[model samples]
Target: MIAIIADDLTGANDTGVQYKKNGYSTTVKIMNDNDVSSSMFKTSDVVVINTDTRPLSKKDAYDCVFKLAEKLNSVNNLEYIYKKVDSLMRGNPAPELEAILDSTDAEIAIVASAFPDNGRIVTDGTLLMPDNKHVDITNIFNTETKRKAVNVRLINVREGAESLKQYMEGQMENGADIFVFDTVSNEDLATISDAAMLIGKKKIFCGSAGLAKQLGRKKKAEQKYDGTVFIVVGSRNAATAHQVRMATETFKLPVVLVNSEEIIDGRYEKAVSESVEKAKEYYLNGNKVVIIAIDSLFEEYTVVLRATATENAKSLKVAESLGDIVKRLYEHIKPVTFVATGGDTAFQICNFLGSDGMELVDEIVPGVPIGILREGMADGSSMVTKSGGFGDEDTLVKVINYLMVNRK
Candidate 1:
C-alpha cells in the first residue's frame, strides 16, 4: 500500500483522488499521530493522512511529520511515501519534507510543487501563480535552517527521463539534498515521474496533486454509486455563488435558501425541519439534485447579519446550523450523495454525522474532490467537497453530470 502525508483535508482528498481515479481504494484519515490505527493502512490500497499542520509552527510541524514518518516507514506493506504539499506552497513544506527524509531511509528528496492545471508552475526555481505573480523557491523554506536545493530547468526535464536522471544523480553527488523541477505543463510532471521511477525508491517525493497523478498506480476498475445528490453551500465566495446559481437555474433544480437570521436566533430546529421538508418534496417530485444555500450570501443584509454576531460565534452558529440541516436531510431522505462547499461547512457536516474522516474516490473538477463518509452514520455515502473560491461557473454543472454518469 502507498501512503500520503498531507497538511490539510482538501489537499489529502485532492491528492488521494488521483489514486482512486486509477481504481485504487483510497481513504483519507483526518487523524493525528496517536489516533492512527492499523486498520487505516490495512483497509485500503492508498491511505492519506491529514496531519493538518499548515497553521503550525515549523518545529511543531517537523516533529509531527517525523514521528508519523518514522512509524509509517516500518509498515511492512508500505510501498511509497508521498508528501502532499500545497500547490501554491502555502504551508511549512520544507520542514515537513526534511522531517520525512530524516525519519525514513530516503537519502534524497525530489520536490515538484507545480500544478499547471491550477495555473501554478515552477519556472527557473520560482513559482508562478495564477495571477502571473512570482514567488522565489528560497522564500518557501523561510525557516532558520537553510537547506540546499537545485532546480532542474524545463530544458533539462524536456531532455528525456534518462537525461534528467543523470543530471539528478550528478546533483546528488554534489551535496544537493533536494531537487526542485521546473514544470510548465502536465507533460513535464510526467517526465519527472519517469525519471523518479528510473532513479529508484531511495528518495521521497514531495509535490502537489500534479505529481501524484503521474506517479499513482492505475488498476482500471469500475465503481458505481447511486442516488440524487444534496448540495449545501455555505461559502460566501462569489465564485461558488455563481456556480450554484448557474446549476440551479440551468438544470431547474430546487433550492432552499437558509435564513441566517433565523439560525442565529436559535430557530435552527425549525429551519432544519422546513428545509428538510422542501428537500424531501423535491426528491419525491423526481428532482435529481437539491441545493441548500444561505440566503443571499453575497448580499449586504447577510453581511450585516454576520457582523452582528461575534467573530467566533458567527462562524460557529452558521456552520452548526448548516450541519444540522444536512443531518436532518440525511435522517429524512437518506440521500446517498452529498456535496459541500466551504471547508467549515464540510467539517461541521462530518462532525454532526459522526464521521472520523472520508474515503476519497474521485474529483468532479480539478480541485473539487469526491469521497465517501467514513466511520459514521453516513458511512459509505458519497460526498463532494469544493473550496469556496475554487472552480469556474460551470463547475457545479460538471458535478451534476459526473454524479448522473457514475450513480448506480
Candidate 2:
C-alpha cells in the first residue's frame, strides 16, 4: 500500500484524492485513528494520514510524525511513504522531515514541492510563487531546527533517471540527509520520482502534491466540463484579481462583480438578485463562461471602514452572500460545470448547494483539482476548486478552455 503523510486535513484530502482519481482504493485517516491497522492497509491501495501538526511546535511536530512513521515502517504491505509538504512551505516541514528520516530506514529524503500547473516552481533550490516572486525555502521552515539540504539542479535532473540517481547516491554517500531538486514542470517532478524509485528503499519522497501526483501516475493512466462554466471568484488575492481581469478583458468573458461591502452589511439582497440576473442573461445570450465574483475594489476600504469587528467575520458574511447568489442561480440555469476560487468561497457554495463533499476526479491544471459534488442538488456535476493565490493571469481562461475541450 502507498502511504501519504500530511500536516493537516485539507492537505491529506487533496493528496489522497489524487490517488483516488488514479483508480486507487484510497483512504484518508486521521493520525490518531484507532483502526489504522495492517488490515486497513491491506484493503486499500493508498492510505493518507493527517498528522495535524502544522500549528504545533517544532519538537511536538517531530514527535508526532516520528511516532506515526515508526508505526508505518513496521507495516509489511507498505510500498513507499510520501511526506506531503505544502507547496508554499508552510508549517513545520523541517522537523517533520527529520522525524521521518529518523524513524524510517530511508537514508535520504528527496524534496521537490513544485506544482508548475499552479505556477509554483523551484529554481536553484528556491521556491517561486506564481508571480515569479522568490521564496527562501530554509526560512519558511521552523528556525528551531536547521535543515541540511543538497541541491539537485535542473541540469542534473534533465540528464535522465540514471544520471539523477547516480548524483543522489553520491550525495547520500557524502552525508546529505535531504536532496532538494529544482523543478519547473510536472515532467521535472516525474523525472525526480523516477530517480527516487531507481534509488529504491534507501530513500523517501518528500514534496507537495506535485510529487505525490507523479507517484500516483505510476499506479494509473494520465487523465473535464460542459454546458456553461460558472465561475465564482471570492478571493481578495491580487493574483486572482489579475486572472479575473484577464478572463474578462482578454477572453471577453462576462463577469458580474458583487458588492462585498453590502454583502457583509446584510443589505445585499438587491445586489445578489441583480448579479444573478446578469449572470443568467450572459449564459442565455450565448456566453459559454460567466463569472460572479466579489468586488475587489471594496475589500480594503470595507475592511478598514466597516464595523464588522474582524476581517474573518466580514469574509464569512461575503462567502455566505456569494453562496446565496449561487444557490439562487441554480434555480434559473444549471451550468455544466462549477468553478470556485478560494477555500471559504468554495466550501460555502458547496454547503449552499447541499454538497457535503466533492468526489475526486482530475485536475484542470496541477494544483487546480476538478471534482464532482458528492451529495447535493448538483450531485455528479463537474466542479473545480482553486486556491485564491494559485495560477497566473490566464489561469481562469485555461480552466475554461480545459473544460470546453474535455466537455462530453
Scored by TM-score, the top model is 1
Worst 10 residues of 2 by lDDT: 300-309
lDDT of prediction 2:
0.74
Please give me the total number of clashing residue pairs in predicted model 1.
Answer: 2
Per residue, candidate 2 scores C-alpha lDDT tens digits across 157-239 of: 99999999999888777767678889998889889988888875566688877777776544332334567788898877777
**Candidate 1, residues 1-408: lDDT per residue as tens digits?**
888998876788788888887778888887566755456676788889888776567799899999999988887767779999877676678889989988999887788888876767888889865445576764455343456787789999999999999998888888877888899898999999899889864878899888888865565434577877888988876778889889988899899888888888888778777877887888889987889888856663221111222654766678788888888778867656888886668777888898888877667788788888888889888888876656788999999888888767
List all candidate RMSDs to the true structure: 4.3, 5.8
Question: Candidate 1 overall Cα lDDT vs. reference?
Answer: 0.80
lDDT of 2 at 192: 92
How far does residue 127 in candidate 2 sit from its true spot (Å)?
2.1
